[model samples]
Target: MQPVINYLNTNSGEIINSLGQHLTISFIAAIIAILIAVPLAIILINHRKIGELVLQITSVIQTIPSLAILGLLIPLVGIGTIPAIIALVLYALMPVFANTYAGLTNIDPLLMEAADAFGVSWRFKLFKIQIPLALPMILTGIRQAVVMIIGTATLAALIGGGGLGTYILLGIQTNNNNALIVGAVLAAALALIASGLIRLLAKVPLKYLTFAIIGIFTLAGIGWGVKSLEFQQQETITIAGKMGGEPEILINMYKDIIENDQPQIKVKLKPNFGGTSFLFKGLQSQKIDVYPEFTGTVLQSLVKTDKAIPHRPRLAYQQAQKLLQSQYKMTYLAPMQYQNGYAVVVRRSTAAKYHLHTIADLTQFPALKAAFDPDFYQQSDGYPGLKKFYHLHFQNVKTMEPALRYEALAKGKVAVTDGYTTDPQIKKYKLVVLNDSRSFFPPYQGAPLVRTEFARSHPQIIKSLNKLQGQITTKQMQTMNYQVTVQHKKASQVAHQFLQQHGFLVQKSSKR
Candidate 1:
């Protein structure tokens, strides 16, 4: 079994990485949508038919499936946030534009006639009479648009945007109910609170006196909220997490601590999820307070030195921690029981036909096609290294989400694919996990990367996390994951149940 830390880190990190991409794209798109929609609204204000057509177009944009929309945009704009932002912006256009148009159109013609009678310029009538009267309604539209974008923006992760949706994606793929519940609930709450505040402001009768009062109060409230969520309370402690794979293990465990543990501590998630380069950058930036890290990965990426060592688990743990402490001022905490490293997965049929028992045997084949997780870093020491060391290369290398990759591998869309050594699908799919003959992929010992400041300020957090050491066997992690994804339980509920069953938490609260 691999260490518990590695298992969690590998699983949970992908969620945050995806989420960051999702949020960045959504917010930018919302802003662009507001900009484009408002001007178009102003132009079509007097034309009822054109205004209707604009609304319909926006509605149509909203109707398309979000991933489909993103895919459609990718070819034209390429990968990452620009195309994603455009898609989200198109989605957000209707509410703002529609409301603005309605507010403008609803303005009394009598007022316009009266202003014209006094030789009031058209610009003056629009700026003074129409706009002033329409401000509240336009704000209402904006409020609606904001809410829509917040929700729809979750899909931005499918492309390459970043935001809060990271948790949602991880929770979904790993079947971590707690992660999902937290993500979904927070998203809904954010939208509700944001929209509610917008409504309250819009409701205030337009007055110069109220504007200053409201602005001051709003700013104060924002400051208060930020401080409240920050300025760690007596119950608060920091948590660090990576972007993909085993990060889930630690996150779920931390989530369980927050949810069901005794002497509760509020969790401040310092999530650092991104691609390999991105995660290393996050580590350099100190954006992450703690994260699950692998032994060999630490050696290869951080040390940038290759010292051939015996394939011993304890040595991997010691070496990984040593590098983190000396180089990063990061404390490497107690490792979890289970470890997750690379494994070759293929259809049950392929395994049987080829009689493939190891990476070496599979290399004998020609025209290899494989799928790898895009978020997975160190494909070099893992899969790509396997290729180079063994002198094997595939004809096709497809990159996709881990979830989608399974289906492709199963259907023979690809001959073999990458997988977690412990993923339960190895059982469910009846797939084969080929052995590593030379053991070229060094042991990926899992341990928590604890920031020095956090260790000083909240040592208890480490001790609390340490309790799960030797608890999360690969098989255990796999089964728990199955309960959530295949069985479709809520991530929060599953985490709580697992903690209780494992005796990590006593007097467990019944599932909510």
Candidate 2:
């Protein structure tokens, strides 16, 4: 509880900012959904066949997973609030549309007939007769849709859409329960508050309710538009990182270096943005200016190669650099002095109990329950190749998120898991990394990858980034990861300390 309090105290600004983003995205999506759905529902009220068909389509959209929808939108619209809002609007459509159609159709047929017999205009029939009675049901649908949008907006953080989901992802990646609690509690609170607002609005007259909803959303949209315009006016460079404490720390370092070097150029950091593929696609689409990538990941995952990449760090880095330039038109900057390569890890107690000393030793325990990171389980350079080379198979294999794997292993829920060499949990949990005697996993040296055109145009930024080359050693990286993940330090603070300690930044004077 104390740690959570401290976390909140330190991150209140970020929390408020994220809350704003969450609200804006939710409000905009809800408003758009309402505008589209209510009109269509009203129009289709007279056309039962088209109404039924539209409802069926929206219902189908509701069945699709939010993540899948985001994935599909990435190629078309790319990442950020646009795709996130689109996905949320799609999800919000069904509830509002269904309920609106149901409400209008299920209204007292006798009242509708009486209005018609009175020779009231169609407008009066809709606004005065049908809408007044159907307001509760329509508002109920809006409430449901608003609440759903608020909850689902968390996933927006994955694609650089700012929201409380950023904290949730960071929490999971760094094992910071405090962040998780804050994000979850705030999201739930937002949903509840939205539901309550709608309930209160239910009591208002239909005319006032309509005006209120429009005015509120209009102000929100204006505020969001202004914020977006402000960002667009700035000379901003968006730098992103993969999910984990190390990537987060590195990106902060990148931000600090670039901002300090060129104060005129603003640096936006998107830490724990997503997996390798997502970041790569973001780079390709110019959604992100730069991100940290590994030589081994490039060789195995990005570049098309029939032959295996050599396990040597220097050679692998060279090949990755050249291939990315020639094939992908991206520049792989000089890497820091660390190899955050893959490792098979187990609890020290488990290793001692089983006398496991190497990868080959794992072959003895076919029944051992192994938990692997999702990417590690599927990537060619990870479990697939290791399994074929070592002939080791675990019957109880589960693919887990990167952070959860360590927790599972530490708690004795699993006997083995995959990890990076510099993972802080290795030290915290007293885990033993089984030696890759056969050297199955390739060396993964961390480097800043940038688009070639961006690199050419922003040589100064590249130079600022190059200051990291050979600066961070394996031990330094492990220690930094430990600081962020175990010691619960902010990545920005840690990066600042590292830069100051290493004389990369000027120390500030203390005024008496």
Model 1 lDDT, residue 309, Cα: 44
Error of 1 at 495 (Å): 3.5
TM-score of each: 0.61, 0.90
Q: Tens-digit lDDT track for model 1 on 340-380?
A: 77777778788788887888887778577778887443456
Candidate 2, 46-126: lDDT as tens digits: 999999999999999999999999989998998778999999999999999999999999988888888889999999899
Among all windows of 10 consecutive residues in model 1, the one with the lowest summed lDDT is 1-10
Q: What are the runs in model 2 whose C-alpha is more than 4 Å off?
A: 346-379, 387-401, 408-417, 434-438, 507-512
RMSD per model, one decimal: 9.8, 3.2
Clashes of each: 49, 0
